[model samples]
Target: MINRPETRDLLAEARQVLLDSLVPELGGERKYEALMIANAMGMAIREQEQQEAGEPESTDVMLSRFLAGHALPEESEQGEQTLARALRERVVDGSDRELRAVLRAMTETRLKVNNPGYLK
Candidate 1:
């Protein structure tokens, strides 16, 4: 059997390399792009860490289950496309308070992963 570093560790190392080695050598738009890449890697590392710590299911999974529980007869299949359409419909209709709450929670969860500084 072979052993390897976890995905989060790999991303962390890659982000560190970008910040410590590559970012210094880059300039102008290239530096900005590299910094953005490093930032994305950091977000991925945080998300992976959250999963490893046994956090709740991802927002997409939770939304899928929510749709399943409230699916219409025409939405029996409950595929990703169907769920997206349903969510959009609910949003536009502006009736389902529960759906609105779920969407808010999902947004916050995504913000926590993507830009925790925004929340602060």
Candidate 2:
């Protein structure tokens, strides 16, 4: 049997404590730094919970797939630049509905990691 204080719950609790206690005392740039730390802790908690729940295909892998589609770019800086240019053009033209859906999902995933509240 598992003991009390699961890893994800512990992280969430610590993040809440920081937000509730120390974050209020901080000011100026320090407050921004505290908030960043709290945000990172929240992401960590989410990651732990997702892993424990048997989520397959990590966020990174899925994000890459969503960004690049099935065909991964040629593995080099020049190729990356080419891919970026192509994606930018497609974004402006708005021709590829599949690409748009992939982008939306990818953006949602990124927003979830960066600021879950935005989704709500």
Index of the highest-lDDT prediction: 1
Against the correct fold, how does model 1 do in TM-score?
0.68
RMSD of each: 3.5, 4.7
Q: lDDT tens digits, residues 1-120, model 2? A: 867987788888899999999999999999999999998998887766655754424544544554466464546644335446666666433556655654565566667666779999
- Over 5-107, each residue of candidate 1 has an lDDT whose tens digit, in order, gives 8888888998999999999999999999999999989989878876776553666566666666675333555444565676566633446776676677677
The pairs that clash in candidate 2 are: none
Every candidate's lDDT: 0.74, 0.67
